[model samples]
Every structure is written in structure tokens, then in C-alpha cells.
Target: MATHPTFITCSSVSFSWPDGTEVLDDFRLAVGPGRTGLIGLNGSGKSTLLKLFAGELTPAEGTIRTVGEVGYLPQNLVLDTALRVDEVLGIAATRAALHAIEAGDVAEEHFAAVGDDWDVEERARATLDQLGLGHIGLDRTIGEVSGGESVLLRLAALLLARPDILLLDEPTNNLDLHARARLYDAVDAWSGVLVVVSHDRQLLERVDQIADLREGEVTWYGGTYSAYEEALAAEQEAAERMVRVAEADVQRQKRELSDAQMKLARRKRYGQKSFENKVVPKIVANNRRAAAQVSAGKHRALHTERLAEARERLDLAEEAVRDDDEIRIELPRTLVHPGREVLRLSGLELQYGARVAGEFELRGPERVALVGRNGAGKSTLLRTIAGELEPVAGTVETHVPLRFLPQRLDVLDDELSVVENVARFAPEATANTVRARLARFLFKGARADRPTGTLSGGERFRATLAALLLAEPAPQLLMLDEPTNNLDMASVRKLTAALEAYEGALIVASHDVPFLESLGITRWLLLDGELRATSPEEVGSAVR
Candidate 1:
């Protein structure tokens, strides 16, 4: 196979919506055969940029140039009709043909678009076989597959296209840890130029570079997401220092300019008349000129220059902070009263269809972590604790005020704006008051008015937390189910940072080991018949 040229290049690009929303300015990005982590806040336009590359939306200004075939994956794709997994992959083989043909780069115009990687079609078959999906019949209907399975099948189809550049947006959001890890492995193995947007920290860390979009611009950093973050922080700190120095200089200049003008004014006003004969006209004229030159506009412009510097520094600082979009639960109030035994379930029983609950003894702070495999009743137990479910015959003792941020954040009213959501959460709050608070979470002004449903997953989580925090005493017990599922790495960091500072207890269930470890989780529980907290290692896949 012949090597391809650069996959894509963007220069002096600026983009925005038809409604006059600015996504970015002077944005630039260059990509090739390596992993690149694409990131930005909810409204940061990461998705918009991808659309441009996909030929779905044209850039409002500037240019985007690319060579070779491209592959794209989107988060939360809706697949209609019925088709088998193998059929989808096979269908993809047919689709790649048009693109290569359109690009006029195929060795042969009539050559099949997607086919065997090597000299045979078996190469493509082997890829699907490795994914444990070889058995899925192409003749079978697609509707039969689970949501996760559907996502996997879609990925397989995209992969089979074998484009030189792949653009993936939240490709891992709907997949389980096992499935997600599998996708990661495929990405790692791929020789194609991979550009992905994901909140998954582990995914971001694997990328060769990070591209940050803000204020209509993109900053390219050399290294992984973490390294880029550290460097950005350092840059922000330096910018802040420069701003401070500039501001001080502006103030001092203002005072000196004021004094000079005052003196010049006095000299001009007097000498032109009674003392006219005593002083030279040239001296008076010179004084008048000097005083005129020192107009208020000049003074204001200096201050404006200083302010511009300050603004730049602030923008840099904000960009660095924005990189981590995960929500931090800032409980507005701290409440305590629960004893060491925040939760206790003895002989606690649970049943789903035909599966019986696992058995166990669990007692600890309100900060309990329910650990179990999917469908193992971890969620069932949480629902039970939240009164969403009733145990068949187990004694239950819980003492705490629990507020749950579910794996799904539908608790947020999609029709309402961020501000509206906050106001509803704290109905007692005035519109101005709610807006002020949401602004702190970066949902400022019109952004707060954007429909909650319009927000990116990261933005939605932040808004959800903001709504929760508005509660007066704050929730004493915070229960999170699959909390890190949709959050990006930056968002996860912010969320964990905030949660770490929280004084209230926490109960979270998730399969993300990295997230669990960062939270200092010690014990785990299985969805057996009852609730039990055990060692972290014990938090393995239990039979449902």
C-alpha cells in the first residue's frame, strides 16, 4: 500500500453558527498518522469542527484541506431498520469505494472500496473475528443487538472502511469497560491517523497530542493530554503575572499623566493674557500644544491596552481550567449526623427476572460504593435504597440525605436552559440569582439560556451538579450511579477535585477503576442477595 499525504489541515479558521454564535477564531490544526485527542467544553465546538471535516458543515471562514479517505464516528448514533452486524461491516466495504473514487486516489477506479486488508478479503474478516462478532449473522436483524452491541457493530463498519484518517467523537460513551478497552486496543493497533474526542481520561492520555479550542482558536500541544495540561497551567501563570505588572503600570501612568496635564493646563491658561508680554508666545503655544496632546482619549487608550493584556491572561487561565470540564459537586452546605453505620443490609435480598441477589454484610460511612457486574442489581440496590425498589425480605437501615446523579442526567429538564434548570432546582432563587450562580460553572449569559438538551455531555453534567448544589443545606449523602460513564477526562478531573473537597459522604458505583482509585475508594459491594462492602479487588465481575 502506498503512503498517503496529510489527512487534514486547518488554517486561520473561524467558525460559528448561523445565529451568530462564535465557536472559534484563528483556529488551526494539523493531523496525520497518530492519535490526536480533540477536546473542548460543551459549547467549545469540538463537534462542529468534526462536522467540517466530515463535509457536513462548511467553515464560516478560513480553509480546511485534506487528502485521502476519511472515517468518522459519532456519539449517540441512531441506527434505524434491521440489519445484522456482519451485514453492516460488509455494507461498509461497499461505502468506502465512493470516497476513494471521489478523491481520485484509488489505484483502480473500479476497485472495491473496502475489502481484505492484505491481498485477500480474509484480512477484513479476521478483524471482525477478533472482536468476538464473527458469529453474528449478517442476515440477522440489527434491532436484536443490545445498545452496546449496536455501538460495536457501527464501529466495526467504520473500521472496515479503512480510511487514512478516522474522526471519532465520544466513540466509547455507550460501551462497557470491556468493550471500551477493546475499542482502545483497535485504535492503538491502527496505523491510520486517528483524531478522537472523548471525555475518557485514559483515552485522552493515550493520544500523541491534544488540541484545545477556545475563543475561535485552537492551540496544539506536543505530548499527551496530561502534559499539555501542565504546560498550559504554566503558561497561564506567566500570563497572570504579566497582567498584574501591566495593570500596575497603567495605574502609575494614569497618575503621572493626570499631573502633567494639570500642570500644563495651568501654564497655558495664565500666560496667554495678563502675563502675555512677560512670557514668549512660543512658550505659551508650546504649553497649549502639550496640554492638547495629553487628551483623555490617550489616557483611556493606555488603560485599554492594559485591560487587553489582562483579558488575554484571563482567557489563557480560563482555557487551562476549561480543559477539565467534569463537574465538581460543590455542596453548598455541610450537614453531619449519621453514625459510622451509614448503611446496613442484613439478609437483604434482591431479584431480577430469575437472578437471585448475592449475599453480604455491608456497613460503613454514607460513602458506600456498590460494586458488581452489569445487571447484578447494583443499580437495583441503589433504587431500593432510594426507595425506587423495595426489598423482598431484607432489613434495611439507612441514615442519610441522598441525592443521586444517575448514569443518565435526565433529571435535568431538557427543554429548559441551564439557568432555568438552576432556578427550578432552587425555585426560591430569582432569575438574576440563578444566572449568577450558573455563571460560576461557566454557563454564562446566553449560554445559560441554551436548551439543556443542546449541551454536550460534559456541560450537562456540570449543569446537573450546579442545580444540585443550589440546595440550601446540600445533600448529606451523594449517590452516583455510573458517574464517570459519559464524562471526559477533564470533566472527570474537575468533578473529582470538587468531590474530594466535599465534606459530605458519597456513594458511587462505576466500573472505571482509575476514577475509583482517585476517589480513595477502599471497599466494594456485590449485588448478591444483600449489600456488602469488601476489598477493592473483590469488585470483580460477579455472576448476575
Candidate 2:
């Protein structure tokens, strides 16, 4: 592997949000030329670190140094729909200048604009092609392309810049399988210092190293994400064993202390009895009793100190273990019979995007994965099925109660508490009943009473899901659109865990292969102007 000098360095850096939420404190990181994947749970400061490196945010303290130019692709990239592809790619001026010079304008400013970048257009085209965006012409408006294509276009822009340090945050969050493959290729071929913050396991697998950020500290792990998982598993296992040992030691210390106290009490009783029986002179007996009492107190103090030290050891051992809990809930009321027709679509055509010309049926407790590129109408289709949108062409028939969790997760009332939002769905249930159900979704006690607007992305998602699953009439068919978007790996796992307990028919639209596979999908449909049944293996192999 070719190695370069450290291109990005952060020393004792500190950063906080506008609300004074401390994200990074005394953070130190030095990265050389290679691909490094940054991963952590949500709210662990991964995005903040990238922003700091890109100079989008100033550090509260310490220094940051970089060797050369830097390019950063933020997680939530919102490009103006009115902007043309060339302008978005930052090549409009150069292309215009080249055109002027080619027309024999002989303008000095045009020459200055086209200076050393005479082949800029060709380079831009090549970059676009590399990122699977050749079909998107530079003159086309941004509104003409899909979300996935827009992401690729942005990455192509960064690639055209050819910065020494490249930072990508959740670059594959909205990409399909084909777009993701192209991104993986780009990462594989990158020669400069690249740091990407993503929860995509496949993307992380292509990294040269893994940097796990937890509690404002970074722990470097050699090799791919799988290697890091193996190392972490081993570490967690050892830590748990130590906790068991420490707990046992604490128990033993307490017992020993109790035994010492009991012995001291018995000896004190014997000495008092001897003094009362007048076995020696009264003054000598009293002095002997006082000495015995002092000795017993010293003995008890030593045992008490040992017990405290043992309890401290137990606390330290427990701290070494990670506390990541999966969502566990039961939805027995949502069960569907094997022969029941849950949903049916007959010649349904969406308002804008893809259309279904043929009849489609979903029956029983089938778990269907809806895989498609962005703007292929996956979300529109789900909304149409949920009756949230009126189709322009055909009909959607539902045989049972169904609920849809939109990608935007706007189902909740921001002003209302999580419990109130859930209660809105389950009107017949009492407030206590709603709170009881929300607890299973990890919203116990005051957490259930927090306003929906106050929750983080993951927390908001959980709250929305709770509202959906706890709805009245017990939805027998659940449709989720891009459910894993913006969720960390842990949150995704929690979502999967929560879904596992749902005994209803499910249709989840997502590009995350690992998450889809984990759901035990019995059917796969590719949405590309039409819905076609496909296999998981075909899904993996069809990413051309």
C-alpha cells in the first residue's frame, strides 16, 4: 500500500454545538493517506468531527492542521432544485469560459477562467461516468434527477476537486445497490486520505481501518469493519468475564466483613462477661474492656475499607461493558393468517414516478423487501397503498388495517408528547396503557412524556414507530419506506429487533442489504417503472 505523510491532524481539539452541547473534547487524531471509516452510535459526534475537519465549524480550542486541499460531502446535502448540474458540479463558469474562447471572443477574463483547466469538461464527464452518473447531462436541472443520482453528482464534484483529504458523511444513505457499488469502487480506487462516517457495513468493509468514536474518544482498529467487530466482541466478552469475577469478589468481601463483625461481637461479649464476673481487679478489667473495644473497632474499619475497594472494582469492571440494548416488543394482536390477502394493487399508476400496470397481491405474514433507486416511486407507492396519496390511474384494495411509516418520519405531532402521539393512534387505550406500550419501545418514565420535537433522529424514529405499532384496530399490514435511513447501526439493529416481534405482513423499502436479509424477507420486488418479483441473489447480482 502506498503511504503518504499525515494529511490531517487534530490536536487537543474541542467543539460544541450552538446550544452548548459538547461534542468533541480534547480530541486528537492524525490520519495519513488511506481510507478510514468512522463509526459510532447516533449522537456520538461523528458528523461533528467531519465538519471540524472540513472547516465548516470552528473548534472551541486547540489546533487543526491539514497538508493540502480538502473536500467534504456532508450527510444532509440539500441542493437547490433550480441549479443546473454544471453549476452544482462547480464547472459552469469554466465551461462557459471555454465556450467563449472557442467562439474567438479572446476575452482576458475567459482565458483566466479556463487557465489550466482546458480539459475540465472532459474531466468532469469522466468523473460523472465513474460515479454512474453519465446519463445526467451537465446542462440538466437538478430537479430532473433522483436523490441517489444527486449524491453521486456531489461526490463527482468532490472527485473533480482532487483534494488531498476527502471527507464523506453517510454518502450511501440514499443510494441504491448500483450507486453504492460505484461508490465502493471510488473508495477502493482513492489514493488520498479519505475518512467516511457511515453505518453501511459494505462501505465500511472497504476501509483500510476503522475508527470507533465513543464517549469523546477514538479507538483505532486495524483492517475492515468485520475485523473491528471481531476485536470488539472479544473485548466485550473479556470485560463481561471480569465483571462476573469482580461481582463475586465483592460478594465474598461482604461476607468476610460480616464474619469479622460477628467474631468481634462475640469476643466483646466474652470480655464483658469476664469483667462482670470479677475475674480480675475492677480497674484492670475496665482497661482490658476498653482495649478490646478499640481493637474491635480497628478490625471492623479494615474489613469495611476492603469491602469498599471491592465494590469500586466491581463498578470499574461493569463500566468496561457496553450498554447497547435492542428493542424488544410483542405484537400478538397484529397477527395475520397465512391465507389472508393483506393488500392488493390493480393497475396502479402513481402521480409522477413509476407505474404498476399489472395486478399485485400481498398475503399472509409475508415480509417483502422493496428495492429500487431513488425517485423510482418506492415512497409514493407505499403512500398510495396507505391511502395517503390518491393514485391517478388504478386502485389499491386493502383487506386488513394497514399502517405506513413514511421515510420522513413526520407521523408524530411535534408539539405533543410521545405518549400523546401514541395515544392519538390508540384512542381507545388509556394514557397509562399507552405509556406501558411505549416503555417496550424504550420510552420509559419521563422519556415517554418528552415532546416529539425534543427527540433525536433515532429517538424520533422510535417514537413514530411506537405510534404506528400501537395504533387502534391493530394494523395487520405494515409498510415502511427507507426505514433505515439516517439510523446508526445500533438503531438499525434495534429497528430490526422490534420488527421481529411484529406478527403482521411487512413491506419495507430500503437499499440496506444486510438489514433486509436480517428481516427474513420472503419476497423481493424491484421497482423500476414496474414491480417485478426478484430473488435476493438476483438483487445482489443485478447492480449493473
Candidate 3:
């Protein structure tokens, strides 16, 4: 209810796609100063709304008012992969200077459009430095940096816009632990309004509020991420209760309607029998005129009786209710017994070029995490484990039937129907059996028939899990590579629950610190190629 400074406010605002299709149905949100986190499952219109807020897309109806400028960092924004890191920053500085000139605050020859204090190069370098992209050696090409680093560089440019508000879309995707920590720190220190669409719980923990986009509407929750989570849990429980109550009511009304219809049918039958046998024969035998009058009276009575029956049946049927789909879940069976030594690395090493893991060994269900600076081979280790890469090592052995959920959904056949995609994993399954199994994961009827390409990221992840589980027996060992990357809140919660109950061995490598903690993984291997193992407690002690 308070006025927002340096924030955007949407009032009865609506938008449609270029095809004149509706997206937001009079959607409303008050993004104010202080950090606010946006959370919704994929295709919930998070990105589209952010674009509208940034003025990239105009609302088709109502008004969007902004009190101040804004800075937006989009998700994994692709750079001119050909441009050098320095060149990109240099261009950004020039653009900012130009914007200042166009705003009539600076002379065309000087970026001091606002004041004599505007230092374009100094400010640009500072922003880039804060994001840890300064070490790219000025001349280093963007292509030379890893995919994650390039993303960060682009974010640095956006931040330098010096806007009064910030809208970040999935900012943590592909980020390493150090980089993510830096972003958290930056956001914590930010004075402007911040609205981010992210699935990372750790990032949200520091936020002042959380909001969700669902069913073409927005719902805001006060307090931190943890509070929002509690609120959502309570809401879900309430919704389920309402659904149950509705179902019970429907059943009760259905029974009443059925009984009433039967009674009406009997009444109509009685009227027919009374007219045919009791009244018609008497009319023929008695005085023709008197009998004819009696017959007409009986016919009139029958018509009135049938009309009453029809009204009663219609009223009863009107009270019955319709039904909806029920939610369910099923994980595959497991057949893996991890070796006494869950993972063994003997003279193990991974090299993308000049990197090496001298030698290391990990054992048991000890729950080890990989962490390091950017380009430090953290992902490479997981890649090697998932067999996405051939370890340039002595011997890396997984003594279990490992199921690897890759960071990306390359295993999915985009062209196939959702049911078919799951079916392919179980070539021996009948079409009906495959469909039935997939339906448990929320892909039912036409949804199952929809092409895999049509599924949102969360659905795609579920589809992948369903397919993998359909095997004769599930794999005992599970390997998740950046499992939380770009996942929705519901999917993240569902996955965290699944991982917690998983038996055998578990290996997860991710930048999601909160997720790892929630799942009880305390040991981490900092991968400066050494893969040294240390309990999170130990690291905490050392840092302290």
C-alpha cells in the first residue's frame, strides 16, 4: 500500500502476444524498493512480465508506472561470442555515455551530462571488477571464457546501467559457487529496488519478499524466502482441503440427483399404467359422452404429472458438480548396491585442456560436493561422473548403477510425444503401460499426447526422471549435475524430496548452497584439480 520509490507498479494491466492472444488477465504487482524475489514454474509468464516492466513489451491495457530507472540482467543472455571481453565492456561504456548525452544531462563531447562527476570508464571497470570478470585480461575474447563467465560479463554490463531498480531473470544459472556468492553479496548491498526470478533458495533467503505467478495471476508474500515457503505449504494444504470438500459435496449431490431421477421415472410409469388399464376401458363400456369426459380428465392429469417430474429431475441434476484431475507420483525401483567404496578415484584426472586432477579418491555415501572459482573444473568432474566426458585419468570407477540427470535435457526426444519419450526408455513396455506410468507424473490425456517440445523445463525434468525410472530396476547411484539450474520452485521442492529419500549413493554438484544443505550434504570437494574432500564444517572453521 505504500508508495514505491525507484520501483514499478502495475494497475489492472493486461498484455497480449503479437498474435492478439491474451497473456496476463488484468495482472497486478507492486515491485517496490528493497529486494523482492520472483518465483514461478516455467511458462508462468515470469520472463514476459519482466520484459514488460523493462519497457521491452508494452501492456495492452491499463497502466505501468515507474518511479525510477531500472537495471535488468536477463537469463544466460547470449553475447557476441566473437567479441573480446574488453571490447564488450568498452562498447558498454560508450553506450552508457551516449545514453547520458541523449538524456540532455551531458554534453555530446563529455559524459558529464548529469554533472562533472560522471566517470564512465571508472564506473564501467568498477562494475566489471565487482562481478569478477576483470581478470579476463582486457584483450581476452568472450569466446575464450567459459559459458558461465560470459553470462556474468553480460550481467555486469546491465548492472552498470545504474538504474534505480533491478530485474534479474534466473541469474544463477551456470554460475559457480564463488560467482553466486558474489551476486548474493552484491544484491545484499544493493540500495535500489531488486526483483529477481530465480529458483535458488540461498539467493532468496536474503530477499525481503517473495511473489509467485500462477494461473495468470500474481500473489505476493511478505518476509524472506523461508517465510514464503511456509506460506506456500500452508496454501497448498488449504487448496487440497478445498478440493477434497468439493469432491465430497459432488458425490453427495450426485447420489441425491440419482435418487430423485429414479423417483420421477416411477411416477411417470404409474401415470401411464393408470391411464391405459384403469381409465380407458371404463370409457368404452360406460355412457360414451361421460366416458369421453373421464378420459380427457385423465389425459390432463397425466400431462400435469409429467411436467412436475421433469422440473424435479432438472433441479436435482443441476446441483451435481464436475470433477478435476488428481495429482500422484511414482519413482522407479532401484537395483544398485554401491560398493563398500561408493566412488573410487585412483590417479584420477580430468582435463579440458590444461587442467588436471593430480590424484584423488572418494568413498562411501559420504555426500561430497564440488566447489571452486569459475573455470575450475567443478562441472568437468560431474561431467566425467555422468560419462559425458571421458576422464583423462588412471581409473575412475563407479561401483553402482548410476542414473545421471544431466544439467541439460539433451536425452529428451523433442520431436516425440511426452508419452513416447518416456516409452522409449522402456522399449519393452506396451503403449498403454507407458502412458499409464507417465500419467502419474501429471502428463495425462492430451497432455501426454503433446509433443515433448511443448513441455516446460520443469515438465521436461519430470519426463526425464519418469523415463529413467521406467527401467526394469532403478539405478542405486544418482548423479545430478546442476539439478536446480533454471528449475521452478515446485520442481526444486519435488526434486529435493526425491533426493533426500534416495538410497544407495548420491552425488550432486551444484551452486545451490541451500539445496545441498537441505539434503544433508556436508562434505565438499574444492576442485582446483585436486578434488580434496572436506566437511562443510571444516571449511567453515577454516574460514572463521
Candidate 4:
């Protein structure tokens, strides 16, 4: 494979949180001018590394160097809602100056501001149009657009700046299918040094290479995410084989050491017996015993050293194997009998002028995927069903105990421990019971005791999921809005596994088609202005 010239370098970089949690220590990475997908498990410092590259964060030690201008889009994009689209796009000043000049003001200052870029507004509009934001006028406020549009708007601003190095962190989090397609198109169009930290499988497939960040080190893999997976699978297979060989070597070394010790013991006994029986002269017997003792010592030392080396080799071999744990828990209480009435929506009129076309009913343990374009009221419908929001002019009737996990995951109390949070949802359950259940969610011992605010993205999701599934009365109706957003691929898979054990009526609002397909969704509903029946095959076109 051809290699691009290196444009960014981090030499012996070290960083830690205020809580003394070491994220990266003496980490070195060199990225060239190509699309590199930075991927890792949650809390592996993918975002932190991107921040360092964008100069949003300074390393505690070592140095970072970049060859050209850098632009960054953070995982959590916070922008002032009052700012105008042009201002957010960073062309407000130029547009203002151009307008002034066009009005015959002829001010030198206006001309200087314009600075040969007289078509700033045209360029801004072009960028927005490219990102599928043409309908969003440049004069509109950021608050007027959908959350997904705001993300694209930020990306548009970065593109307008024309930076040499572009660093994006989880850029497709809240995007719908159409918006995500636009973002993917933008990614495909990028030619400069592009390093994106994302869990979006489709987005990662477009990258030129994959940079797997694990244990404070970056391991580069040629080709896209699928190719990276293939390479990693092969690598792990070899590592496991080495581990088996090393295990055998360790066992053989232990057996040899034991055998040598037994032989030495027998030799000592024989020497003592011969000395006592006067088989040889006393002086000669004593000398022979000493010599035997020395020989036994040498043999014991040699065997012990070999065993130690073998154990060390085994440890190293074992370290090469990945330990990606899956969530495994059964929820018998959440199971609903066949033909059970789970949910009903009568003349459902949701907020923001969205409504269901007619009466809708869900029965038994139906798994439904609610998909739509941005600003299509999918979340509003889920919120209404979950009883967090009041319907404008209709009714949402859930027949069984229900729980909703929103996109923000605000169900958790940031100040409380995971155990406490779960207890909050299931107040009648004892601390021991809650902890035991939390352990099944991969929060064992001290992990269950850590505050929810201190957890990584994946850990927080698990903690929240544990609380919801273990809630009092058990939720037979579960609604999740964009549950897979901002989640790592592993977390997504773990979530799929966890949900597989759930025998409840599931309604997940997501743009992640692959994840939805994995859930055994029996029904697909597209929420545009009204809820309509869809299919896994029609989902791609229906949302667009």
C-alpha cells in the first residue's frame, strides 16, 4: 500500500484527568495526509487525542507538531443557539462587508474585510447546500435547525475554513439517514489530512486506513474498517495459538521442575543413607554429599529460572488476546405473553405539529424500529409514549410497565454511584440485589460504586441500561431514542446482546440500520409527519 506523507506527529505525549486518571502516557503517533479512522473502546482516549491534535487540549508532557492549519469538530458540539448560520459558518463579517460594498458605502475597511473573497456568501451557501442544508438559510439562527443540522453546520464552517488537517470526533452521532448520508459525502470529498474518531460503521468504511488506539498506543492497519477487522481477527487467532503453546511450555517447565526437585530429594536421601551406612569413608562421604548438594542447588536454580521465563512468556502471550466482554443478563420479568397488549396510540398528536395517521397498536413482545429524517418527531413520539411529554391532542396508552432510555441518557444521577442509580429506579430492591444485578451489566465491585459522572460513554450506557432493565415491576415496554448514538462498535454489539435477552416490546428510534437489523425487529415504522408502516428494505429510501 502507498503511504501518504506524515502531516501530524505526537512524540512522547502524556495526559491525565484532574482526578489523576491517566489516559495516555508517553504515547507516540504519526498520521499522514489521508483519511484515518481513529477507533477504540470507549475511554481509550480517542476524543482526547483528537482534542490534542486540534490544540483544544495541551498535553501534560512531550510535544505535538502539525504541518498545516487544523480544524476540529468535537464529540459534544456546543454552540450558541442565538448565532446566525453565517456567523456559525465564520463568513458573517465578510458577508457584512460585501453587503456594505455592494450598497455603495465604498469604505476601505469594508473592502479590507472582503479581501478578494467577495463571494463569501455564495461559498457559505454552497457549503451548506453540499451538506444538505440548502433549505436552511444563512440568516437563520442555530436554534431554528435540528440538532443533526447543527452538527452539519459546524462541519460546513470547518470546510469553509479549508483547513489542511481536519479532525472530527463522533461527527455522525445525532444525524439521521439523510443527514448522515450528507456527512458521508463530505467525508468522501475530503482530500487533505483527515482523522476522524467515529463508531459509525458506514463512515469508517470510507476511510483510507484504521488507527486502532489501544493501551495508549496506536496500531495502524491498512485499508478500511472491514479489512482492519479481518486483520485483527487473524492477529488474535495467532495470539491465541501462541498463548496455548506458551501454556503448554509453562506446564512442561513446571513438570520438569517438580521432577528435578524429586530427583534431588531422592539423591539427598541416598547420600544421607550411604553416609550413615558407612558405604564410603566419612571424609569422602561428606565430600560427596557436599558435591551432590551443590549439584542439586544448581539444578533447582536452572529449573526455577526456566519456569519463571516460561511463565513470563505465557503472560506476554495472554496479553495479546483482546478481552472484549459482552453483557449477559436474562430478564424473565420483562417478558410479555404472545398477543399481550403492550402499547396503543389513539389519534396520537405529538408536539411540534406531528401526528399519527390513525390508531396504532403494538402487541406481544414486538421489536419495532422507529426511523425518520431529522426533525421528524420520532423522539417526541417516544417521549410522549414514555410519559415524559404530553400529547398535543391525543392519547398514548402503555398497558405494561414501561421504561424509556433517551439519547442523552439523562436517566442517571451524575452524583450517585451506579448502584445508587439502579436502586433509585428499583427502590424496593436491597443494595446487595442491585449490586448483584449490576455485576451482570459489567459493573462489578468498585466499578458499581463509581459515580455515574465518572464513567466513560460505554460504562455510562451500561449503568443506565442496568438501571432501566432492573427497575421496579420490570419494564415490559422499552423505548429507546437513538440508543446507539455516540456508542462504540463494541458497546453497540453489547447492547444488541443485552437486548437479545430482553423479552419486552422494544421501540428503538435510530438511524443505525445494522444495529436495528440485529435486534430482530418484527416491525418498522417511519415517522415523518405521521407514523406509517415500513420495512427493513424500504427503510433506507423511506427515511430519505
Top candidate, metric lDDT: 4
Model 4 lDDT per residue over 84-152, tens place = 999999989999999998889998999999998977888888888998889999899987776778899
Q: Single out the weakest 10-residue window by summed lDDT for candidate 1.
A: 353-362
Q: What would the per-residue lDDT of candidate 3 be over residues 1-544, giving only the tens digit for each residue? A: 2234566889999886553446687877777788988877665678778888888788889888877876677653667767876566645445456566767865655454334535655676777778876676555687677667877887776666566878888887878766777788888888888888887778889899888776677778998889997987887666666556655665556555555566655655655575666765655534554554565556555655655555555444443322223224455555334346656666666765424345454455556665555676666777777677886756677766677777655688988888888877788889898888888777878778767764555667777777877755566667777777766766677777766666556777766667778887847766554666666665433222
Could you tell me every candidate's TM-score relative to the true structure? 0.69, 0.87, 0.67, 0.92
lDDT of 4: 0.87
Q: Over the stretch 355-381, how does candidate 1's per-residue lDDT look in tens digits?
A: 233333333433556665433566666
In candidate 2, where is summed lDDT lowest over 10 consecutive residues? Answer: 324-333
Model 2 residue 485 CA deviation (Å) reads 2.8
At residue 263, what lDDT does model 1 achieve? 66
Output the lDDT of residue 231, model 4: 100
Q: Which structure is stronger by TM-score: 1 or 2?
A: 2
Which 10 residues in a row give candidate 4 its minimum summed lDDT? 1-10
Candidate 2 segments exceeding 4 Å error: 1-32, 57-67, 329-332, 337-341, 351-353, 373-375, 386-392, 408-439, 443-457, 470-474
For residue 191, model 2's alpha carbon misses the true position, in angstroms, by 2.9
The order of the candidates by TM-score, greatest first, is 4, 2, 1, 3
Clashing pairs in 3: 105-113, 106-113, 333-474
TM-score of 3: 0.67
